[model samples]
Target: MTRADAPPRPENAAAWPRLAVVALGLLCLTEAAKLVAFHQAGPMPRASDAGAYWLLGAQVARGDVWMAERPVAYRTPGYPWFLGAVQAVCGHWAWCTAIAVQYAAVWVTTVLTGWWTWRVSARPWLAVLAVLVCVLSAARASHASLLLTETWFTLGLTVCGFLLSRPGALTQSRSTVAIAAAWCLTWLTRPIGAALLPAWLAIWWRDSGVGSGGTRWRAWPPLVLTGVVLAVGLGPWVVRNAVLFGRPSLTVFLGRELWVTTFGPGRPTAGGLPSTPEAEEIIRRASPDGEFTDWGGNWSVSNRLTASGLSDAEADALMARVARQGIAADPLRAGLRFVVRGIDYWRATYLRSLTDYDDLAGTASDVRDGQREWGNRACHRFRRAWLDAAPERNLLVVELSAALALMGLAGLWLAPSRRETALLVTALIAGIALSTAALEYPSYRYRMVLEPALIVCGVSGWPVLIDVIRRGSRTL
Candidate 1:
């Protein structure tokens, strides 16, 4: 194909210096903003899962990987182990250091996001816009202060996208290994990483040259190697869970999350633990008051069962059984719930956390009321303006969501005729979003990892959109 008919190419080498300068400037600005946000958020005390991670890190520092009295399979080991390693070197856990590292990871994610967009869309300016979207996203930046997997997972996803978007990445041995390693780390950080496997297989099947003149057997090595890496990366934790519970489970929390989303009041609506009638009966029978507090649902259920003479394994098994039964009993309802959950996941905004100014509060719950009030006001504003009617969601989040969704659609419309790139991107986003929705209520935080891909897609179509607008103006 001639240059004019071929897909748009990335900027020439002469533009590299300018791109580098722009990337560096954005990095510096983001880092500065992170520091300011961190200070404003003020020494955030480890709360909820953050506290659990801290305690687990302390235990790991003392040479015990399973810190809890019982085998803890609820959370994956990646983030806690990361914190443990940092604390081991620093002599104690330091939020400052951890947040700083996450900030740096954010910067890396931003750069890789830009690079991936440029490779796929061949638009240098759009790539810069992708970078800006990532860097300026208040939701993305706020994770720097929270000891969560968002930062690490975002960086992992971005790096994977960048690597796989390279020409011949699926067929090359080195790129295959790099992609495999990145994926393994990603799975360790969050179970959602498994969703990317189908995308990988799709890319490999299309690009690996197996069907043309090559033997099909040649494709097995990379696929096998990736599987082996994943197994090895997650082996030890799986083994521990197997030994402790007599069955290997990726995460015990899956059952709990399913129960909550399928049967409970769902996200942002707190109620008694195990919101299903059957699960509630189980917990109530175990408790003296015939009720369980909503605080720490996972622990509440587990502890109540264990207190009533059930082993940790038994409690988990029971919870899993309860969740499965709930789904099986009403398959149609479950399917409908999944649709609603998917909508909830995408429409969610990080405004509550962004506007939160309760960093100095003694307890995490101390500023919840204020955050809720702010969120309500945001919802009201959106309802009165852009949205004829709006749900109880943040206005900024609603606007951002609408903008990203529109741009992303435009990007897909303007994408090259080659189906491979579009397929891969769609699969990744759909896989993560749908899988999460199927099992749990989608939180904005959980969906944040996909932001890089969204930004790329949103910016990819910007040039096409502008051209159309210009043409229309001239015609007028």
Candidate 2:
């Protein structure tokens, strides 16, 4: 829909064609790779996390409604339930069609990302270059074909970033409403969207001045509406958790993860106690804490839970005791570890070839038939050989990375305004940091979500870099 008071179109509208052609070419290449993989794998319903997501879809397809269940409730219902709805219409055929639908969605997101770059920079060539870099990136292409939640989660986030990237979008009431709806939808799509909370609050605080009467009162309606919409989408899950699990929890899996990650076997406990296997052996030999804080926390939590496990109060007491012990001994050290772990998570390798990410394919492939399972030295050799098999295809990644990094630096230097530069810088830093913190799976997949934005900055920065080089040569 056209905005009634939208600014006049610039004379450079004709130049968008070249941008589209370039973007299209990149998309064609990306999609071609995905198509080949899909054809070979028959849609990857057997991938690691695919079982849970596919089952959710199956349940939805069969009209079996689920409420909050541990592990399951941790996932926001947008994607699996979405696939389930698709299955309802398409029946068993939807299983095969799911990956195709994801590809289509990703393609649309790529196009929109390009358009957003063009809108912000008003540079058609830069926009196309950004799209090209995103498509060609190895990290991005790896995850694009998977039957994972990252695809949809990334899409919703990208759209939200695109919308909020411009102040003008928020100035128009209708546009603001639309963007807010998308923002809420994004939160509904993934728990990571919680990070956007600070950004939203910042926007509301800043824009309170623009509302009617300059009293900030008019802003309340939209703010409240946004909250309500998000609640309507997410409240049912919380309610179900409360009723079914006897826990008024925001997420289903955090407590168990906390117990496991913080104090399990081979872990450093809250009291600065080193939990070697001996501790586990001791725990097994002794009465132990029965609390969920030590020894095989992951397996125990999932396996030991009955129709009704420990109550919320019991869980809290267990956590508190462990945390107190942990804090008393090495508070500073523990804090540092947590911080480092968070950084490690944020910077974890998420971008890599699909073969690299898949345990089943790597182990089962003919290339790995002779590989030693104990040391995996043979598997490594096979992987290297297989990866090198497509020597020419590797050039795409090298060029893409170099181009994007260069363009990103250039964009920061050449950004037309401080605000624009800050947006790019903040997003690049935050996206990478957040993604790294949330996942330990080191494949370029984590980077894919930020590819378009990174590309835009990189492309935007190019001219500035060239100018500097030319100026330096002249000085010499």
Candidates' C-alpha lDDT: 0.66, 0.54
TM-score of each: 0.80, 0.70
Best by TM-score: 1
Worst 10 residues of 1 by lDDT: 366-375
The TM-score that candidate 1 achieves is 0.80
Model 2 residue 340 CA deviation (Å) reads 2.8
For every candidate in turn, the CA RMSD to the true structure comes to 7.4, 8.7
lDDT of 2 by residue, 1-476 (tens): 56967888879886677757765676657655543453333232243566566667667777766622333445666776787787777764564466567766677677777777776667777677667655544345344445577777677767776776666444456766776778666766666666666555555545666533467675676576667766776677677666765656545555444444354432233343344543343344333355444343543543333213544434443443443454445666555545655544323343234535345332332221122222134433433343345322454654555455545555455444534444544554465545444322223454456556555556665665676566742321
Report the error of model 2 at residue 333, Å.
Answer: 2.4
